[model samples]
Target: MFTRFSPYWLWGLLSIFPIFWTYLVLASSNPSIVHILVHPSGEWAARLLIFTLMITPLSMFFKNSALVRWMRRNRRYFGVASFAYAAMHTVFYVADKGSLAQVLDELPRLYILTGWLAFAIFVPLAATSVDFAVRKMGRHWKALQRWVYVSAVLTLVHWASLNDWNSPLGAVVHFTPLVVLEGYRIRHHFAMRMKRTA
Candidate 1:
């Protein structure tokens, strides 16, 4: 059975795993599990971002955007998944501390405000991810989604704030790859534009 058709089962399974796992872990955890669960959410966000970034490079290498059709189809879903994690992380912070006002008051101290802001940006982007919203926003939808870039940066900041030593070496390691990926994307776009002009 495994030899018969691997592609259909493999990619399809991997793509949907995040969604299933998110809900599954959320439901299965005990009351003390809130912290552990939030960790997965942050990690999931990073994983989803990396997955989305991989799409273009994979398409380029394969010489076929069709290879990444499933990724394109589920980009919004992974994005929303990331937002779900971030939101849950926020909820944990608020709930554990007890009181929205206290959380808001201490927000600056924990630097959770950065995470809050990043999640806030994700809200509208996720809300308007559908075709109807794109049509309604006209050309503005793309610009609005550009907030993801800002959200990504803020996410790194939020992660950095959680560090005890402010070293954030791991965050730098995570972010540097994305910086390189974006650089490649920019260069690729420019080269394409130049080729078109030529």
Candidate 2:
């Protein structure tokens, strides 16, 4: 079944289509719908980041090395899409607020501050994503790339802390997969260390 199609591009396209579709649906709705669209679009980007992050862990745990190959090949696309949605989110927010002055007014607010930090964190990660940039940055590349994890956590924080922490539905829905993926990576890393010592 996997042989019939190109895994990376084909699957990635399938994964991302719903995001654009949702954006269109939201755009066609109420004038105040931009916030709704941006939030979920940003969430989808986080989810894709999880999907990209999960590929290696899944491949390792299941002993399917090809999955890692396919995922790594498309990892850049995931990062790129994450940036794209984030950009859309910023645009929506700016448009929704009407002007720079209005946006500046919201800047001191917690929701705006949290989201601003998350998007600010993503900008550099996206910029340094290419092969040439990575090679040039050397060890700094890995350090800078860890910003994705920060962005992911900040994304959830931005959403969860918006109204109240008691609203666990949104956090649970998004954070669960991230927790699982991180757990798997922890186990995989420990196992590798154990093997080296053995």
Candidate 3:
């Protein structure tokens, strides 16, 4: 079944879930609409970002795995989707804040500042997630994309510090796998370099 259709088509199909979720959120008559939208959108953004980052290490570890191969091909989609959800999350937050002065007033808070920093990093990365940018930037493209690591760390800090660091378990749980995989990727890279030198 998977072989019959292009990956883009599969991605399109998968995209319906987020589209539907957004529709549901927007259509709801809930009084706390901003509150309702913020957390879920942020979670989706983080999940997709993690999935995008996971592909490289998974590909390295499971060179022959079809799933990893598929993920590699669709990695850009995951990244763009993450940015889209992050955009939504930011929009909802701004709407919740109600005014520029109010928003600026909260900018000094650690959680808010980190969240904005992560979103700021995401903008350039998302803008350059294209064939033209890849060709034009050449080696520099990868260097720019590497900033996602910094964005991920900021995102972790943002999530964990919410409510004065009162409920960090969710953020810790979500990010643990990413931390472990990245650690392994670094170790594997050093090990390979050592082998080459040996």
Candidate 4:
């Protein structure tokens, strides 16, 4: 199946998914589009970011070379998709506020500020994700991309502080697995460094 379809097609298909959902949500008479988009897009972004981080550890844990290869080949798509959904979520937020100026005014609030900072980190990461940027930066590219983990943590903080129980509970549910996977990766990397030094 992978041999038959091009990655460009995958990109286009994934790109259309959110737009289609947005249209349907707006067409409904119940909840507003802004309401529908905010939660779904944010959750989608969270899930994609989680999957992007999982690719390496899951493959290694299962001793699956095919999983590793496939995930490595497509990791960029997942990263980009996560950013897209995040942007979509933010756009709906601004729209719900009636104007960009209102959103800016609210930026003084902690939740809004945290969310802005999270996206600020994502901006440079997304900009430098291309092949050209990778080549141009060489070794530093890996260091720069490491910021994704930071952004993910900031995103969770932003969510956890947003309200009462529901948001924090959601954060715990979504964040626990990511924390565990990253912990494993850190331990493995440290052991490898120790072995090399010894």
Candidate 5:
């Protein structure tokens, strides 16, 4: 019964995010909503991306089979949410600029280009997210999805370079959990390598 309803639970949880954030954006004042739309949308994407990355290491650490299963199952949902918010962020950017051409003109800027590159990586990852794609692509699908790590790095760069960390935005602080998790992963890799060498 739990298995049957887990997807429903996931859908409901996911639905809350879009509905709440969209409502906040819509209710916000006009001039402030410009920043409101872009920031919340982009930050949510980053947060979800980090959570997706954490599923593997976190599941490994906890040693809880049910937790592991849930994380693995919901990972794709988190990934899709990440991409959706990224799309919204891009839309907000273009909308704020008031013209597609105006936004295009800024593509040459380093920060803008970095964000674009991250979004580009998201496209294929989101496209091939289905189970059929997994079966069809087999080994290659995993390789393609590894690009997600590259996107994460690019996203961090874009956020850091574009926003102030010490300000109310707390941009850099938002990635704290991800940094800690990744640090744990790095240490574990070295520990394994040392054991192998011994």
Candidate 6:
């Protein structure tokens, strides 16, 4: 059955798997569903965003790997899916808060503030993730997408600042590989430039 559909279709299906799973969990009507889903949904959003960002450095390092090339082509799918999961996370958070006033009360907290800022950045990036926007924005599209780096930093802070900075291992572990690969990418580029100039 999987053989009949193209890889793009398969990837698209994979991208939405978390949403499907969340729906299944919600349908079960667990009383704590909002609380249960909140962390995982945010984690999925972060993971997908990491995957989306990893493509460029991985492609640079791999150079000729078909899998990396495929990931590069489908990077936007991961990005948009990241936004979807993030929206879900935000919804679940609001539901858990039970009132707008309660939610607003926590907005002054560092973690909450950073998370909202990251989500704010994601809004425009996700909105323009279409072919039409790509064509219309042309060179500017990439510049706008660069804001994802800022979002990533805010996400890291948001995750780390939870519980008064008592627990940050999960967020640190998840982001470590992306940081390493990006560092390598920068170093490699600098070395190449030096070689060219020499």
- Candidate 3: tens digits of C-alpha lDDT, residues 147-195: 9999999999999999999999999999999899999999989999999
Q: Which lDDT tens digits does candidate 5 get at residues 1-198? A: 334556777777867867776777688766767666787788888888988998888876877677677778778988988898898888778778988898889887767888999999999999999999999999999999999999998888788777433342455677778888889988999999999999
Q: Worst ten-residue run, lDDT, model 5?
A: 163-172
Candidate 1, position 81, lDDT? 64
Off by over 4 Å in 2: 1-30, 191-198
Write model 1 residue lDDT over 61-85, tens digit each, in one string. Answer: 5654554665555566657666655
Q: Give stretches of model 6 more than 4 Å off.
A: 1-8, 15-18, 21-26
lDDT per residue, candidate 2, 84-164, as tens digits? 777776877787677899999888876678889989998999898889999999999999888888887777777777665
Q: Flag clash pairs in model 3.
A: none
**Candidate 6 structure quality by residue, lDDT tens digits, 23-138:** 76669677887787788889988998988898999998788787777777778988988898899899889988999999999999999999999999999999999999999999
Task: Give Cα distance to truth, residue 167, candidate 1, Å.
Answer: 4.9
lDDT of each: 0.69, 0.74, 0.89, 0.82, 0.82, 0.89
Per-residue error (Å), model 5, residue 97: 1.3
List pairs with backbone clashes in candidate 4: none
Q: Local error of candidate 6 at 86, Å?
A: 0.5
| TM-score sort, best first | 3, 6, 4, 5, 2, 1
Task: List, in order, the clash count of every candidate structure.
Answer: 0, 0, 0, 0, 0, 0
Worst 10 residues of 3 by lDDT: 1-10
